[model samples]
Target: MGVLDQLRKEADQKKLSEQETVDQQALRAKLYKTQVLPKMQQIFKYLQELAEHLNYLEVPVQVENYSDRFPRLGTLMQKDYKINTDGYGGFSDFNKLVQINLTFYCIGKGELEYNVQTKSAIEQENAFLHAKRVASKMYRLGGAGREESAKFVVTKKIPVRVRFEVDYEQSQIKVMVNNHTDFSTYTEVWQPADIDDAFLDTLARYLLRKDSEFVSLDITDEDRNELRKKLQSIKHKEEQERLRGVTEQKNSGLEKKEKLGDKMKSFITGKINR
Candidate 1:
């Protein structure tokens, strides 16, 4: 091909690419305005209402805008808030404080995802220990000490989530709730038609209910048995050590008493001899 012809073709292709890029940007902006922005606003309002509800319940809560944590794409954003129950004397009367996190993700195509998680002030292992301690007190520990005494704590958190998506092409709103901590599996708790006033009210009420009734991690039979066994073994070892310490103290006391008696006898004998 001629040099001029090749150059012309390259220029045409570059122009076409630029046009396509501009078109894609325009489409994304349109989607964000029509689909994403409304949902985002709705979520913000819902969060405000939720915060008010939590305040009414006397729970300390703070909402934060975390959209800057992601790229400023305008099509996606996130907001996070935390409910601090530390002042409430922690979970189940434990000294440790528990913070509940609520994260809202606004995605393109009219999709809003909400995640509710339990945040522990302690390490994951200690969280499991606390759970085990609660389980022990609640009598939820089954067959741990009777069979295997090695597995004492099974710690995990299953966060709850609610997802709302608008299928513009399909002309329907898809709503799903996964109230289980195990993200791998989802249980459909509620299905709403549209993000209308009624739906928003219902969603707010549902979230409030969840806030009051915290998510509980599911402990399988195997885990329960193992935890019980480990707790039993620990208790048994502690008891043994305590008994050993007491026995040693008693023996030491006896030895000291015998030595005193011997000394008294020697003194009396010397007196008699004298």
Candidate 2:
């Protein structure tokens, strides 16, 4: 080939490569907007509702993130391309993926904390109760360990799954401890400034007649213990009634035997007199 022709071909190829890159970005953005954005919007609603229950005022949905629409799959030739293209210059089925993560900030009064308390047992109990409450809430919501399905036939409001990510921030406080020594002990208190806890715990119980996961989020220690106590009481009463029923049957049999003996004694007495 002539040198001039070779140069022209090389130039054409470069332009085509650059244009292909733009096309890919465009298409990725387009699908992201049309298909992905709607799901994201629903997820945001779920998060917002969660925050609202926690009484978080000014829980911003961060609308600015959605401003940049997903562009149409970037392209050069304006011909339609399928989702699966070879790595060199093709499409991918998993192309338009945008990850959304949740972050909670406490801009409220009286935050929560975790620490070595004076009553270790009480602290342990609190932790245990909280975990149970969370689970029971999930169950009532029809999310109890994947055993059963939960649904609302009327409204069809499904809560989005929010992945749990624990983030801790604390504010330190200094307390003076006086012992028998000349020098006083300095204790630094670390308290939680914010907590993204299950806010729907109480609400869940109010509505849940059963442990269905399709309900609300508020589950607490008192509620759980109350339930346990009730079940125990019911079981005990049922056992007592069952035992009482057996005793009654035995007594009735004994009384019937005694009556039969009396009848035979009276018949023998009459026969002798006759």
Candidate 3:
């Protein structure tokens, strides 16, 4: 080939390569903004909802800004809840309160950590009761490791940790529940599609009801069952409303088509008559 032709071919290839790189970068940025950002926002929204639900349930919970704690992780949110043996009495004994920390990582694959710790000695009875309460609440929100954490608290009271780590790329979630005692861990793997609010709520309510069987509290089985039924009824009503909306939209479209047909017919008749 001539020297000029060779040079031209090289220039063309170089330009194409540069354009491809730019296209790839643009695609990556679009994916991050649309898919990754929305997933992070959804996780953050649910976390906020969980915190609100706890507060509504009269649990002493505090939400804190933890963006600075994990500077490398981009955006992070944390919430701390203090659960005392005595309900709402502001922790009469330092040892009687269990501190639960929840952290959410909002970049790359999202990670949620639920760590519970007690400063006082682990009383098996109190520890068991506390673990059940904490686990039940966490499980309701798509957390796993309840049995193992309960066992850990029952045997040795130091700290129980349950973590839900999600990989958006792989669409998978890994759950680990662990305790300081024996370093025992329970692991569960799930697909992101399998985790939903309804599933989590149902599981959580079931756990709470099971726990109530052992611990005597003001909330009874009847009360829980009633609440479950009420929630189901609400869901049914929502579905009905959604169906009604779709039907109305279909009817509106049909009405518009009929009006257009009548106008067309009138126009044709007018033209013929003229």
Candidate 4:
């Protein structure tokens, strides 16, 4: 523990004289006053300084109510949507937040605003149709996503941020699409999902191709048999539930044994006392 404690312990075992104990204690007090305490104080202060530098804490993010009335004036350009490391953030997990810095304006006598929606949510409706075409093609390819001959879902959902602003009197509207994002060099590129030949080609051909520039294929048939097959494929991911059931059974057995042992111990103790 400490030099003084060690010496005192040694002295106790060796049966030192009272005068010697007093003398050593006095010497220790002097050393503490002159050397040890000051050094310990310095070390404590250094440690406190180091702790302040090492400390890292999460910044509490304020969630904006999308339906709330707009603040009189503020800039998204002035504020950064900080990324959270603990897996909770304003945006989705896979979102590559392309920073856009633009001033929200109220022109003449009107208020201004923009509506945001995820590209994934829009495509998820048609996911079954994509899967059906994929399965159909996979038969020709002879397999699925495996080492052997298989088909890959060659479709990816691309996110788009559509900005439409209306003035307070509702007389004016602005619809803007940037060749480059509104701010700092369009840096965030997030490929959220991978697609194989079937879905991609269908979506591209139906909505995003040069010939399909005016069309958007956003709806899907959920009652389709292809959708049911997709659901059936992922149906039994219950291994976790199975493991939990086993653990619960073991714990229950242990609890029953403990109760039985307690009852036996009490009965034995009663007999012994009698």
- Rank candidates, TM-score, best first: 1, 3, 2, 4
Write one digit per residue (lDDT tens) for candidate 2, span 199-255. 234322211212323222234446646655655565576578677784453577877
Over 1-274, each residue of candidate 1 has an lDDT whose tens digit, in order, gives 9999999999999999999989877875666556554654564456556755555665432222313322222342212323222323232212221122243322222322222122232234335435323221111222634421122222112233454443333323344444322122222222112346765665665454434222222454476566556555655765786777844535778779657755655543333221
The residue pairs in collision within model 1 are: 144-228, 144-229, 145-228, 145-229, 149-229, 151-226, 152-227, 158-181, 159-181
lDDT of 4 by residue, 1-274 (tens): 8999999898887776777778777875665444443333332333234224323332222222211223421321111212221223333222221221121111112223222223343244236335322121121222355333322222211112222222212122222222111111121111111112342344223211124321222223343344445334333333444556744535778779657755655543333221
The candidate with the higher TM-score, 1 or 2, is 1
Using TM-score as the yardstick, the better of models 2 and 3 is: 3
CA-lDDT, candidates in order: 0.41, 0.33, 0.41, 0.31
- Specify the poorest-scoring 10-residue window by lDDT in model 2: 73-82
TM-score of each: 0.34, 0.25, 0.30, 0.16
Model 2: CA > 4 A from native: 56-101, 104-274
In candidate 2, position 177 carries an lDDT of: 22
- Per-model clash counts, in order, read 9, 31, 0, 11
What is the lDDT for 87 in model 3?
33
